[model samples]
Target: MDSYELAIRNTVEVVTEDELKELLKKPEKSVYTGYEPSGEIHLGHLVTINKLMDLREAGFKVKVLLADLHAFLNQKGDMEKVRELAEYNRRCFEAVGLKGKNVEFVLGTDVELNPEYQLNVLKLAQQITLNRATRSMDEVGRNMDAPHVSQMVYPIMQMVDIHTLGVDLALGGIDQRKIHMLAREYLPSIGAKTPVCMHTPILNGLNGKKMSSSEGNYISVADTEDNIRKKMKKAFCPPEIEENPVLQVLKYHVFPRLDSITLRRPEKFGGDREIISYGECETSYAKGEIHPADLKSACTEGLIEVLAPARDYLGL
Candidate 1:
């Protein structure tokens, strides 16, 4: 599939194919995807990583930023724990087959390598008003009262990463859309081309809300086959929820393969399964043509198949 098709399936909000193509035409242009290495990299993070892989396949230079400093700012705790978590996260990237010459992992603290970078971030922060900055507070799970001056400047630092790296495109999840938009808005004022922001849909928790670490609902990237299978089995996959979280995770990541296989094995899998597209799957599912149990099973197996290698890589 082409980049536009991939973007659509990935639920990114680029204005048009021409726009994306123009961005892609700049072969020298880099694409940046950052991860705050505060906790284990989860399935939610994988969706974004998968998108990064697609961008790389399309010939963009991909830079994976380990947001170690951001994590430290947001989730204040022991420094050693933070460092270990960042290291573990770097390994997760390796385990998931994301490591290569094209993808460079840079720690946030590595700004020291170029002393001027942090100053640039502070300058970017100065351009935006408090009103605009507060709009991104929901993303960090903080409010105006709770956020310190440094915390408030986090998005500025992130935007600086884009400018510092000189990326043509910025990749993130929907939750990060605001910060990205902020960067896009402020960058042009500073004479930098506004990086096109591409975001993947957020995978909800098993119960159909956004996934949360504190809620104990996330499935880590290093999860074993047994762990993945068990988690899928226990997931709240009831039919009543309009956006069945399990079904969404499957549609975005699993159902594509199922559609391909179902076309090939109509009789074995079921009747001529015309799930040729995700739209068809969503429609069929909404009409109850496909049972949730069958969908869940297929999702479970697909996730297991996809994550099995990572699990093995992690020696789980």
Candidate 2:
């Protein structure tokens, strides 16, 4: 694929195609995505990490914000704890192939504590209403029923992050669409450049349920190969194509890394076959030409192969 297609493929939306195209024409530009520091970096994180890698290949400088302050302000933990998690998060991103010169890892407090950054944040906070801020955090804020004042400040800081980072594109999962749109609407009022936003689809866990750490349904880079295989065996693999967690894994994770997937099966069960593309695999599976057992087997092995670098990098 060409640069433009590579940058936008698998993305649910780009705020403006023209704007992104224009940025692509530039010799140099930057893109960034922020994540609250998590103790474990799972496949849910990899989806966007993959996109950042693609952006790097597409010739954009990639900035990954380990949103430590946002994590603490959103009540993830104490500042000290979140700051430590940020370091681990940076290592995780590097292990997953975001290493090298084009990618930058930025800590929230490093810039956030600066008087200028704090002033910009407070300036944006003045116009953003409490209702707007609360609504923007619908998918991300913890403890919404009786949210603390910090929760309301989270989205506003997020808007300011795009400005402070000075990125040409802001990439995130669709969950952040509201917050990005908030920036588009309000940033220019503060004399900050409105950011172009790219959003990726959210993938479900192996159980075809929401990916939650508590449930342990998602695969983390720290998972051993044997553990991954076991989880894939128990994964929800309904025959139908849509929302099949195994199929989603193949589409979002495996195929992107591998040119094609080899489905291994006994000769009695149609033997081994190489599926050349995600579309072809899905079409065959939807027609009942392939069995769920075989599909799961392929996915189990494919994910193992695709995630091997990260596994090895982390020495797990």
Cα lDDT computed for each candidate against the true fold: 0.73, 0.91
Model 2 residue 287 CA deviation (Å) reads: 1.0
Candidate 1 segments whose C-alpha is farther than 4 A from its true place = 15-18, 143-145, 255-280
Alpha-carbon error at 26 in model 1, in Å?
A: 2.6
Q: Which stretches of candidate 2 lie over 4 Å from their true place?
A: none
RMSD (Cα, Å) of model 2: 0.9
Clashes of each: 0, 0
Q: Write the per-residue lDDT of candidate 2 for residues 219-266, one digit (tens) a residue.
A: 998889899989999999998777899998898888888988888988
Q: For candidate 1, write residues 1-316 as lDDT tens digits.
A: 8755654466657534566778766657678887877567887787878777777777778888887777676654555677678788888988877888688888777762376886677677777887777777566535456667767777877888888777888888877888988887787766777788877777888766778888778688777778777888878876654668776776666654345313223455565454566666667677776777676666677777777777888888
- Model 2 pairs in collision: none
- Give me the displacement of residue 118 in model 1, in angstroms: 2.3
